[model samples]
Target: MELDTPVLDDHMHLDPDHGRGIDAVEDFAHLGGTHLLVVNKPSWHLGVEAGDPDAVDPAAAGEEFREVFERTIKVVEAASDVLDGRAWPVLGVHPGLISRLVDERGFSPEDARDVMQAGIEVAAEYVADGEALALKSGRPHYEVSEAVWDASNEVMRRAFECGAEIGCAVQLHAEASEDMSEVAEWAEEAGLPAERVVKHYASGRLAGPIPSVMSEKERLRVAAESGEPFLMETDFVDDPDRPGAVLGPKTVPRRVRWLLEEGYEDAVRRAHVETPQSVYGIDTEATLSE
Candidate 1:
């Protein structure tokens, strides 16, 4: 299906183990996707292989994230070469890593904050240098202790501050909750605009001033009721081991087609074209023209 307006996937992952690389990107484009916000997954220093997050050198962990951030820029460049500037990187430290540092890696809250701030600094450099478009941080609700949860929130607050300093939008990865007013409040306090904040992998039921990357499973009625300035995503993990883990790469394009068929062309245009442009500062026309 071809869309008159480009369809954007607000959040996705691409790595050797997760996103399956360029071929998967091609698949997404062939299915009518025009833009993507690709995120960098946490580093091995954060314990991707080990079930346990034993204590590691904080400097070593920071180095691991540096390497990953460099690789993430390369991935974005490669995807842009393939997709003709349709792909952009959203760089930051994952909040789950903060929990690991505090809970399993034996990091003092101060030390963990230092490491997280370091990661955010790297992300800010990328954004300031125009290599990345946005920053991301999240609180993983599951599999974290209460202390870790609270610590993650603090880390995320620092992330918001980083985004404010660097003038980059922040995409948050957290579960859908009835009350997200605190999120807006925090963003405001940090000097970040609520309109620039994104709730990644959000449900249609979510309501607030902050924008959301709605899943394909979102109800159309709920989407309509939620108001304007929303985006769509598949959150494709690209893990061969967990095929279709979150959703397929083609999910957003297909969803756009479905929405168009349902005669919601204006809504599709707003979500796919206008919202992304306003939120991420993407030039959709230039991206697709390339």
Candidate 2:
């Protein structure tokens, strides 16, 4: 499990109450993977019921999300003991929940946005308190009404603002697209550099935010060879029903080893060492040594 450079999965999830949880971290550790950014799951996944659309109290909305974010931080703290490097929490409301708030919960688009923005503000509090390393937010990747879309964008902008104020990164679960000029513009307006904004589950090098590319061999090679600032991830949801669905916990380390064997030494170093430190502002060497 020892590696010369730290292998960081920039975006991942562990559902201790429902899935493999820390055992998944053990799997990664056993394969030479070192670090993780454990993102919070959606509220429903963490056992938070959908809010009453009729009572969209902006003041109480964050309290509704508190348990979900706290649980994610608890898991990350526990996971630090299992990982060879470290596990940092990335807390926020998942963007996909917007649809549920609107359609299933009967929330109007604006109310749903207010609820989500409040959740992001709560998440920023955790980062500000030093319990988490980053914030997670993005517009829905699925179709929605134009009003819902506009509201979702506002929520994302709020995330950017929170991240800027807290002086941390924001990991985005956005649609798969190369042209992210609009998002780049938003980052600029929020005063958080595009380099600190990561596109989670990205397929290749992207325009705006730094990409956290899925750790498949070909895609990894493309991103590495492009010589851009990027990171790698499994995007492993750790769902027992869909075991090893997106990619297994062992995927990142194994792929990094494969690239090392392929003589991509510099590429491996860029991905595992340099880029992560530059983007997340964490000391990879210091973390792995610990």
Once all C-alphas are superposed, what RMSD does model 2 give against the true structure? Answer: 1.3
RMSD of each: 3.0, 1.3
Number of the top-ranking candidate, with lDDT as the measure:
2
Among all windows of ten consecutive residues in candidate 1, which has the lowest summed lDDT?
A: 45-54
| Highest TM-score against the true fold, candidate | 2
**What value does the lDDT take at residue 277 in candidate 2?**
83
- TM-scores for every predicted model: 0.89, 0.97
lDDT of 2 by residue, 8-107 (tens): 9888999998899999999998988889999988888877864667783843687788899888989998988987789999999899989988888888
Model 1 Cα lDDT, one tens digit per residue, 22-77: 78788888887778888887665323322223445443444446677778788877
lDDT of 2: 0.87
Off by over 4 Å in 2: none
